[model samples]
Target: MRRLAPLILWALACSAAAAADVSGRVSTAADGVNVVPLAEGSVIEVVLTTSGGEQVRTFAARDGAFALAGVPAGRHVVSAYNSRFVFPEVHVDVTASGVQAAALVFNGAPIPASPLVIRPAGVAQYYEARKAVDVVGFIKTPYGLMIAFSVFAMVVMPMMKVDPEEYREAMSSLRGGDGGGAVEQSGGGGRSGGGGARSGGGMQPTGAGAQRRQIRDR
Candidate 1:
């Protein structure tokens, strides 16, 4: 149960397809450490949002593997967050084509929720991304796996948008990169993920969610 979210997110994130191959090695934006590939029993998460504020997506990381699938082609906000480690928000764009080699970095400091205005979505992206990279960067040492897998991903939200247990469970298995989870439709027209985890299209995107609020006033 606890590990499900990351495992699912990783499987889904790696599953994203595009007009071209939507695949590349992951690394840290700051230092550029190549993130290890996803493995079994590893949990990771990411966040994604659109510029138009239309779609938002979340992903899971398992065994150091993760993915963001079923996203609309355009420039969008891709943030990195985690409940355990500290990182900053990075804005990236996907083309009508797709996303290629992107690195989500851990800023190594606590990022307050006030900035994003959305807690879990932003925080989770960092945690997941940090964890994913750390897992792969492990260099076997006399001590053990040379690298420390656990970075400092702290959860700071008080009244979370989702349940505490879920948030924690999601957080533990969570980390965010622009917050995009592959969407699996209940029924099928062009539905993907078939009984599998899908992208985060259904969830109101942070940018779009904010936009809707503005529209109502106008």
Candidate 2:
């Protein structure tokens, strides 16, 4: 029995280290008011990612309030979603002794939940129905597609190659100038005048006097 004393203390320490609690209220904006509590059945899911792996739990709010106990201590992302709304993910750190609190506010209404069904189905029909429902769900929503496309464009568009000549022509058209006409004319005149004058030893721009004149002109 004396040998068991050390094991008992280690067990108690592990239990304490794994203990955590989270609580929150779910609310929505009301007319002329800051916020109004949501109805019961709003679902809150907390996802904990630790060195051990990821753990998930779901809790339903009662009268807009919810509490989840026995969560493992670490950092977690809490996401609240329901038939009417979706809240942004909230980040919280869970300590052994304190409760992590959250206030979730949702702006836009989400797709309504399907009605409950109790009818039995064959194996093939069950899979077919589930696949159809999932496809419909993906098609009926625009947010996921929009976010994916936006991210894809931001990442891939920069890596795509654009023809320099095409870009120059487009800019010239926008500026009411011919593609290479303006560039050729201006560059030729500037080079000839600057190069000839400098080579003829008439106030070469390599000296301090030319710099003073340029600064005064600016």
Candidate 3:
């Protein structure tokens, strides 16, 4: 029974972190510090070594981000290196599932340390839960082949409708505010369309003279 103590504790820990996701990105430099994403859809080697020398699991996934589930909390050293000679190595520490750290920004050699993980596990869960880019199918017919590139673009491109310019404009407008009362500033210049709309929203009496109708009649 004594030998089973550690095993039992391990089992419990795994169960606790089963729903926990642990992942992060390794950049070549700071945010937009001028480094390409390691590789597009290329799996890099990730080796995790713990202080206790546990046989940690490693996975080969796309370069932008990586994840490992069921991580029993402690000081964990995660080393990620791409197979191809492109981006530099990215090292990160998973102090636990609750510590907020910096995003692993990779640049030249001598990679600097960043507190990329406030809650390491939470960050990983967020990236993993995010839906990946979806690519659509293309036809092989002559006409289809002629525009196959366009079809490929349509599929590969992210379905984002919000234009950056429009979003910035809206943000700027909100910051400036609505300039107080918009309706009051209308100066009764135009026909009382605003009043008419409000009146329409309320119950307009069928045989009314000029008196406003009550809302309950609706």
Which candidate has the top score in lDDT?
A: 2
Enumerate clash totals for all models, in the order shown: 58, 0, 18
Model 1 lDDT at residue 213: 93
- 1 or 3: which has the higher lDDT? 3
RMSD of model 3 against the true structure:
34.0
Global Cα RMSD, each model = 50.7, 30.3, 34.0
Candidate rank order under lDDT = 2, 3, 1
Say which prediction, candidate 2 or candidate 3, comes out ahead on lDDT. 2
Models 1 onward score TM values of: 0.29, 0.35, 0.33
Model 3 has a clash total of 18
lDDT of 3 by residue, 141-183 (tens): 5566768768667875644566899888798788764554555
Candidate 2 stretches with Cα past 4 Å from truth are 1-5, 30-52, 100-218
Q: What shift in Å separates residue 203 of candidate 2 from its native position after superposition?
A: 99
Error of 3 at 94 (Å): 4.1
